[model samples]
Target: MQSTASTPELYLAELPEERQHIMTALRDVIRENLPAGFEEVMSYGMLGYAVPHTLYPAGYHCDPKQPLPFMSIASQKRHIAVYHMGMYADEKLLDWFKEEYSKHSNTKLDMGKSCIRFKKPEQVPLALIGELASKMTPQEWVQVYESQIKR
Candidate 1:
């Protein structure tokens, strides 16, 4: 996977037409709902939104130079994934969302700590996804992280 650590927008501009279409749509939807301080970024070879710097000086565990992200979108070899960091990392929240997810879709999506994989964008419920994205803000996220770190 190529890294677009610098010039993320330019990088996205160069993606394959099909991938670009999906990324653009996902990026726009995510951008529209993001909380303050979050900016567009290219991380892990995909388009992701993150806190610019105010809250997290060192982003995720893997990349410490940027602000840690709350969510992200990636184009995989076979599918795209929208990552909801808090949901998967937070047991209570994940369980709550699992119940909620089941109510609307019978399909059981594959999940990793915070990543939810979807074969296509249509499979994701935009409204519910928006709610999930809006559930926590950078400030609230930092507070949660700090408290957890203290443990």
Candidate 2:
């Protein structure tokens, strides 16, 4: 569900108490392992990590006014989701994640192009998510976005 909350803190606070804990843990892991240069912000109603305009004035090709998004975590209606733009843009990265997922959790990987869905909060692999967050720097993401995904 799209949240109307104005800030990440508010967004977390708005979730149900049980969800608040899961989202908070996931957010913390992403924040701790994410490379330098990514700014945490409220993007598309979720907790987003992006390359600020100062770092990439070109911004997002889809919306220049918005910072270039790198990753995001949200509590969706039926699951908690982690979205990594890098995984979508880089086939190697996607393959690596798919392989590593099996080593991290007993549950099958539930994923889409970029979104990793966890139907049960307990099944979420915080360490794996943290490693994924660290896999790309903002500069690297900008490069990938431009060369591969941007129109």
Candidate 3:
């Protein structure tokens, strides 16, 4: 469901304590490594990293009214979830991410096509997450996203 939240602070205020802590840590990592053109906003009832219209006016193909979503983090009922749009379109990145995750994290990788789930912040591979987030500039991500839309 799309969030009625218009700000990050509002999103954090609604999360439970444990979820707040986890999301806080992950948010720190994201804020630190997020590229220049990406902006953090609340979308789909979660924290979203997006390409503002100024950067990619076409917006997300699914909903042109919204900005293009690069990634999102949410506190699900069962676990913390990370949605990485990059891996969905890039097989090489997916393979590399999985291999790197296995090498770095002792916790079993619980992942969907693009969503990575973990219960605790300690289970996350901080370096891997940072590296992945910083892998592409806004322009590069737009190219990758557009390529998929074309096919």
- Clash counts per candidate, in order, are 2, 0, 1
Superposed by TM-score, candidate 3 places the C-alpha of residue 120 at a distance from the truth, in angstroms, of 3.0
Candidate 1, 32-136: lDDT as tens digits: 777777777776666777776766775565657867767887777777778877775577778888778876666677677787877765676565676677777
Q: What is the C-alpha lDDT of each candidate?
A: 0.71, 0.93, 0.86
Which residue pairs show collisions in model 1? 59-67, 59-68
Model 2 per-residue lDDT tens digits across residues 1-151: 9998989999999999989998999999999999999999998989999999999998888889999998999999999999999999999999999999999999988999899999988999999999999999998888888888545
Off by over 4 Å in 2: 149-151
lDDT value, candidate 3, whole model: 0.86
Clashing pairs in 2: none
**Candidate rank order under TM-score:** 2, 3, 1
The lowest-lDDT stretch of 10 consecutive residues in candidate 1 is: 1-10
TM-score of each predicted structure versus truth? 0.81, 0.97, 0.93
| Candidate 1 ranges beyond 4 A from true positions | 2-5, 58-63
What RMSD does model 1 have?
Answer: 2.5
Compute the lDDT of residue 12 as modeled in candidate 1: 68
lDDT of 3 by residue, 57-146 (tens): 999888998999999988887778889898998899999898899888998899998899987767877778888898778898899998
